[model samples]
Target: MGKVSTFSPAQQAENTSSKIVVALERLSEAFRVLLWQEATQYGLSPIQIQVLTFLLHYPEEKRTVTSLALYFNMTKATISDAVKSLEQKNYLVRKPSETDTRSHSLHLLKEGRAIAKKVEHFAAPLQDAVATSPLKEQGVLLDQLMQLIYQLNQEEVITHQPMCFNCQHYTEKKGNYCTLLKISLKQANLRVDCPSFETRED
Candidate 1:
């Protein structure tokens, strides 16, 4: 004889959802460890490496300490310390903003760029695993992940950074448009950390 277990459909669905949440959490922690391991090789902290990589991808306008603090959900003092350490290592340069003389913008130096390039490949394993899926499946997964990120931001559980879909300047019709810049945006051009991003009020 075999023991039988019974549960309602809703309870079964809840159990499955709980497992999914746990799996996502474990995956997130694994990626963090991978980043930390790569950072150590460059003699940098994880936050410094993150800032360098961010500056490499984003424009100078978004390289301010305040922006980094917001993106990382870190305090200004913590970001300032990381920026100062990077400056002392000659991996980054601080320049006074032309638009705002009181504020400084971060620029990655040659060494910083090199480090960013190296760290960028730290997620190769994850990428390769995702690549094994069909292209359409990959796209579906990305959309699902982005939706979760957007929801978390909306809930204020995470710091709200710039995303094209939620920006006041963004519009969708025949194609994506940036009303501020008056430019047509391609799907690939939708940025996660756009410099001109302004949150659209609901």
Candidate 2:
């Protein structure tokens, strides 16, 4: 039963999990294609566009090359190269880090915000498709996705995720509860990224 391979036609056919994994891989491919199309329009690499998009929403503390490298699971050199290109294109600036004077944090410029807004919609099609699903079905899918992501984060497969399931406030008491928020969370209430997240190592 342990011998399952999503890439193998026979195994994927026999195993529902394998088939779902294959579907996820296809979705990832779709994401890459969308990112490429958006990047090409602005003469930016996919990673550069991603960096701009991320910097647009994230706070300054999380906008450093090191943090970006970790979040994207890419090498520091790769993220730095992307940052350099963005800087050269007048899209962002590097300000000295408030915490570490020797280090720097990314600041998205006005032009970068405009470009990021355009490129960030690269995944709008996927969102629209998901929006078409029944409300309950979307909630179920969100639960499945968040649990999978939480497991991946626990195993260190996904390096950085500030999700509800991994937050200090999270609990399984009477079906998902937030100790800090003092609220019970349903599958639909689960958060993929919560700004108030405080990491809990358990």
Candidate 3:
């Protein structure tokens, strides 16, 4: 008789989760490309659109590069590059941070604000369409997604610790990187065995 092939319950769960991630990633990328193309009609890149959108809802109307980097989980250099480009295009302005001289606060200029407002206005119908859904359903979906994200993060911590520890870009700063990321490093170490972990260039 041929040997029976069977996967443990854990193995089946892992396989299902992996497939879901791939599907979600592809869907996200497709939407992102579509959104970027839409932004081009207003002469804005996806990043610029995000920045402007953030600014519209930001209580302070501005943020430091460090703050933005942390919010976006990005590197300082990348944020600086984006800020410089926006400044040159008159879409953003940089001012000295009162709290930290070394760090500068970024503010959208009048032109930038105007453009952002336009984008927001243009997106109203789409936003309204999404908002029309029942709040309970939206909340349920949000909770489910949050739980899945937490599970994935826990798995990553278990599977990717050693790889993260050896990465040159890993910093030990508090509330910033490394240390915070290390809180779940054990699971991450178990998640992936890849040795190379470089910060995103963007």
Give the number of the best model, judged by lDDT.
Answer: 2
lDDT of 3 by residue, 1-202 (tens): 6532233444446577656666677667766766677588887677667777666666452377665665555677877787787788898888887777776677889988888787765455445655887766655554455446545555663222223433444443632245434643322132222334543333
RMSD value for candidate 1: 5.8
**lDDT (10s digit) by residue, model 1, range 50-140:** 8888888988878999989998999999999999999999889999988889999999999889878888777778778889998777666
Q: Which numbered prediction scores highest in TM-score against the true structure?
A: 2
Over 4 Å off in model 2, which ranges? 1-4
Off by over 4 Å in 1: 1-14, 169-198
lDDT, ranked from best to worst: 2, 1, 3
Task: Give all TM-scores, in the order shown.
Answer: 0.79, 0.94, 0.59
For residues 73-165, write the lDDT of model 2, one tens digit per residue. 899999999999999999999999767898998998899898888888999999999999998899999999998987888799878788888
Every candidate's lDDT: 0.81, 0.89, 0.59
Clashing residue pairs in candidate 2 (N, C-alpha, C atoms within 3 angstroms):
none
Give the clashing pairs for model 1. Answer: none
Lowest lDDT 10-residue stretch of candidate 1: 3-12
